[model samples]
Target: MFLKSYTGADDARIYHNEGDCVVRYVKEQCNRHPTNWPVEPGTIVAAYAAHTRQTLYLEQKDFCNKNHPLGLGKPGKQPQRSVILPMLTPNNRVLAIMEFDKDETGFKEEKIHYALAYGSWVTAALIRKGIRESLRDAKEYNATILNCLKCFLHEKLTLNQCISAIMITMREFIRAEKVIFYHIIADKKLDADIYEATSYNRDIFTKVSRKIDLRKDFLMKDVAENHVVVNIHKGDEEQDFKKYNITDPAINSVLCVPIGNPKRLLGIVKVINKVDHPMFFDIDLVNVSNAGMYCTSIIFYTAIGKQLDNTITIANKQKVTLTRHMIPCIHDIIQFRSRPITKPPPYYLSFDWYPTKDELSRDLLADYVWWMFNDLFEGDVFMEKFDVFVLMCKKGYRKTSSYHNFEHAFCATHCMFVIVRTCSQKFSYLEQMALMCAMLCHDIDHPGNTNPFLKASEHPLSKLYKFAFLENHHSNVTRILINHCKIFDHLAPDDYKAMVDDMHRLIVATDLAKHFRKKKYLDDLVKDKRFDDSLPAHKMHLKSIIMTTCDLSGQFKPFDRTREITFSLYIELYKEGDWLKSKGLPVHSTLDRTRYLDIPQDQVNFLSMVVIPCVQLLVQMVPVLKDPYTLSCNNLDIWKRVSFSKLFH
Candidate 1:
């Protein structure tokens, strides 16, 4: 006999072996005639089938009752004893198995051990899945925040715009109760002007100004000086929250972060409480502060842009006014006052002569010229008088020429006044004025040409003053005109002679051929520091050099205007060159080639290389000339390079 207990079937069964490990059963089948035993000994198929069906029905009922699949089996209700056996196969081959009561202590212990092992595997897999989900969520949140920041920066938004954007994004993401932006003024006072409060009243700006002492306040000073974000939490014993007026209903907690450049503190930002969380941490403060830094830089740059725009606008307005008023006056004076006299007068022949014009015209010109002189000469009255005389000559020329083609004469007069004003302060008002009048009339009726033309025409004055220095002939012509006029009879003889000598030197210096010679003379005086005592020789040489330089100083004007003047000179020079070439005559050295027509460029280059250096050297030698000479040199260098590059290039 073999015994077997199977958990799947739930019945303990006894198997009787006949032969060759086979089992047989004796029972009746329901569908066949009732029989207790097999009639045929070989095989009772119906009886065996009936027994198998009965066994299967008993097994199913026992399995359900014992195992209690609904977990309703109680220890008290279940059976305690069961046979242990090897289960038999259908062929009666034995297999190892265990049998016990459903509620047996050993069976329960085995079941508990299996359940715990399965639960542990499931729990561990769930925990791993949770951790991966948390990491992925954190990564996505950070990526979203970074993308928002990138868009904000790319827009080139202003400080207010950036701050507003940040507040909106942070409210949506971080969910803060309030955000405040503060800024420090030059006086080191801080004010919280930018405030965004979602849950609280936003009227903090009006209400809080009196409560905050940001400059000397103990709490703010720490954050500002350290340039660090401070995270304040409720019930934190480390700091005195009462002093800051922090209460539960008000601001229970705050994250204070300093706004700044690398060099200095700009201000601070304070974020108060998390909407969902009760406590805020230093990490939250750091996040907000990092965003605030971009806002601070934008504010600073915007301020700078406004300042530059204002400065440029003011400068442009000043330039326009200067061009409209000052330049025309300067032009009129220069064009009508510096020309040679063509006719001789009788009254001024014996004494050195001085030209005179209509009394009313002279007075008008004098007053106008005096106003300009006063503006330029400021403290010097001597130069003002000298300028008046130059104006008188300009007025005289305008009257004689009927005010036509008076520009060169006026320019010459203006240049002569500038030279005398800059040269010396020694001459008395009357003497200087007389000297200026001589200089002006010394070149009246100039014909817009040179001494060569006079020589070519064999003009009577040229014949009489044959081979004389051009400037001396100009002086003689001036004297002749003045001597014939009854208007200058009020002058003294010796005073007139002294004026003539001074005027002679100034007019002669205008000849371009004498430029090197005059420059060399001035350079010698500069090297010797000769102007220290204002000796006659030093004064004379200084005067001569100044007059010469002033005549050529058009190159040192503003670059654009200088170019216009140079273009005019080019036309004049080109015409002269063409005339000489047509006559089959030898051209002057300075005009020997068409290439030299660009003399303005060459002269500007020379000023940079030579004139500026000379002027600087002179300033070092003569301390009194230091400021004016240095300024002149700088102006020349600047205009020369700028004009040359703009025009030639």
Candidate 2:
């Protein structure tokens, strides 16, 4: 009903791209009004257009022709001619594809052009309608949840009834097959209290209420104690079922949320197997978790005769922090075919080389990364997966951050390439690869806040990582992406293990807090003339030192560029400091925005103390590192000379 059109065609269809596949959103018959009929993805003309984001015109010269159309012959009524046009958003994101067919005459060029023009209006209208409908649906859904909570709070519904009703509501919204609630009995056993099923597994629910031994069930125990959600999308159903002691073959995916605050144990809610969607996404997890919070409150009030307002508030805050740190979904995983790039200038490998915006744009960076990757590694498997790995790394970086964005990651990676290229013979191939991966993902998913700020603010990440907080997080994200893309799938077992170990070591070495200690260790090795690449300990020390050098390579860029990068970094740091001050938390002097006037001197001190020392040590180890070392010293002098007032201007 949303899109009603008569194109003098026999039939029409509308397709929407949903995470990796194209699904039919609407279907029409004999130019009648279209109906919203969702269908799984297939190799149809509309799907092909969505995949390629290009228009396709298929003409059947003869009605009885048996040859498959475009090698994609689905069981359907064959039309004499059909044309598919992809509707795209402003950013070229595919919204839908409109397929027009004709039983008698083919679409002329003018009609196709007209359809293209009409698609723009249709896309805008559909987006506006989607926004309005989403808001309306959200409001109604929230009201339904609130009504359930009110019924429970007023004692109009028993605990089981209230929770079961809420579960049904949640399952409906999430379109999940079943929502099961289990009550914890004195920290020893999990007793299923409520089991609500939509379809397909009604018989399994009776058996699903069996008690689970908390001591024996390690996964369930972890969920109850640590308040961690277990979200399994695919490929681990059998193993997860064994842990839960379930035999339901229909459950392909699962999302389990713990229902309690930090102070006490309550229960766990399991949302199993999304109906139509292939996997449970972050939004689904969020919805189930929020419902679990409501259940936690309801169960607590029923037992303790008091509301858990403060605890629930704290739990919500913790959930927000956890979700913020959750792995971001990779929306676009299109294979990147390497293209020819204008070769970098003669000084591209120099420490002072700074790429223009045109040279470092997203597409150009992809090209540069691919070219540089091929130049370094010759493994056929690595070459095949390298494109996806680069795409994942780029997607992992939070572009909203002022300083630690993809641009900075790529620049640091370029600096690492310079080091690896110069010392190709010194470091083994795996070590060089580790260095590149570490630099490329060293600051991924950065919240643009410092470690002290995270600790003082009681962020969930601080609880997860007590030391080298952000570095560990970045390293973890990098590892997840690497595994997700299967970048090293073809490496020998020992080589793969060594690659991961070295990458983790190199990534954590980028932590600035540990810089002084690492610097002193490397300095002692060099001063005592005991530095040897043959010794594992000494080699690790050198790798750690060089990691710090590449991390701070921004300090050695041309003076103006260094100033720009430094200012961007302060912008993020000062913002965190402002938040900390507002929250009455301890703020580091360098992070404090009120001390902006002291920034130039602070930069001078950091470079002289941290940057110069690290680079100097690396230069001693690898004489070719002198270029960046000299640039660092010169930048330090420049920062020392600039007055605070003129520096900002």
Candidate 3:
């Protein structure tokens, strides 16, 4: 529809077009130009052909003969003769026309250049539009995948189910042939046992299940170590297939993607072959792999939940037995200590309540107290020296109502045991009895509640005893119980004071706020190797630390048992925190509500960080504590794996 125009001093013609085939017409103009320049016609034509190919959508070969044709073919199958031509494209199919006059030189050359430039502009515009469309499509696809993953997370599906669901979505989206999941196990093995092989290839899956050791397989090892997706197209058989034993003829291509856990190698997802068309897998593989990893994590967490539930059941049974026997002994000791002040013996201590007359006897109380002492202390030296201390408390009680009952009696017994264990052979009978009596009465008439209750009641004990000197009040109670109680009328003066000091140190350590300070002191003493001494002071400190250690040793109990006890303790602490908050009081930092429930994740992490270390430290300090330490450690490790396994939903 357009014509070429000529403008030059030399005799040359030009051809051009206004249609889509402008570049082809430009070639015709070049061919018609005079070939008398310094450059050879063939060279100029080749250069023009290359330029046209780069700037326009025209084929390089078709453009070659525009200016000058290179005869490129066999003799019999001769190529077309050289000529410049206008092209027609009325029906979207180009028709070549190699007609042009021989004398259109300089003007033809200018027209050829103009046509080439116009064609280039059109091609560039089309390319830019194509790139924009591709970007939009990619963004939409990514949004879809992210939305799907969020849904899976919200649903809380197990890792396997999540992976399978994701694979189905991805497979349908991508139209892939098969998606195979492979998990990496400890010892660097691939576990194909827990896999989702989608594509309706039941027969192939059966074969794979029977023969694959996923863990030991070479392909899994490579995926885990590299932590990347490996794409293999057909004919790229350079990999040592013999080593992997992957002779399956059906596998023409592979996309092996590593599913990485934040902490370790979770597994791999191998998408095998492409449907509809043969295309090489690329970075899109990572999208599928990430989905698989999410699934694996869900499965792992589920397993841990089951294990914890079982452990809690076992722990509850143990707690019932412990509470029944231990609480009664504790109750009796409390009653014995309060006997001196009440004068009539507390209602709980009367014949109607206890019913047994022997329940209040010194010998029976002494024997029962000694048995508990042995259970806790685990030695014989304290039992033999107990009688001398009992007599001193009896002697001291005649002067006052302080050391009369079993509460002071037990406290005195505990102190005497501490001194006896520490002083061993050097312990004096009178000193042991006085100390025992003082320890027994230290908490006599004790209100069941601790500091928070004291503050709330505005009790006389709370006012007389400021928080800073609360330990002094305990000392005062011990002195009063021993001096005033008629039951301890048999104690010597010097023995009583020493007993008060030992008992004072032990009871005051029960304050949880002082836990860190006590730990620091014990750590320092242990570092100094102070256990080698038999001094009463060192012995008393050791006994105090041991008692504190037991008090805080709830976490080290068997996993099941500890959970039940800890949950109960957690609830109790939570209630206390609530009360303190209501009263506008500052609760302890550790009693924050966020930490009270022992959530599974927190519990597992605590076992790894706090519980294990504490138990190990106890065993290191006292080798005899090894059984509980080892048991707890083993259980924790098992639970961790179980938790991980269950999470792989």
TM per candidate comes to 0.35, 0.51, 0.37
Worst lDDT 10-window in candidate 1 = 51-60
Query: Tens digit of lDDT per residue, candidate 2, span 116-194?
Result: 8888999899778766986787678779988988888788877767776777777888788777767665444344344
Tens-place lDDT per residue, model 1, 1-649, is 1111223222232333221222333245644322132211233222232223121211213433322232111123434333233333333222212233333332344443443343345445644664587467546645655664566558655345555665555444445677776655534545434445434544222112332456455557667766656676666543556665455566666778887753577767777766534456444665676656655655566677788899789867854553233222555556534532123233322111123445234434344344434444466534523443444345434333322223434333455464445544655655455445554564554444456856765666576664444556556555544443323455577765666566666666556556555566666666675654357766565555444444444444444544555565555555666777887877763454567644655656656765455445444544444433554465566554553345665
lDDT of each: 0.48, 0.73, 0.47
**Deviation from truth (RMSD, Å), model 2:** 32.1
Best by TM-score: 2
Highest-lDDT candidate:
2
- The clash tally of candidate 1 reads 23
Superposition error at 222 for model 1 (Å): 99
Worst 10 residues of 2 by lDDT: 63-72
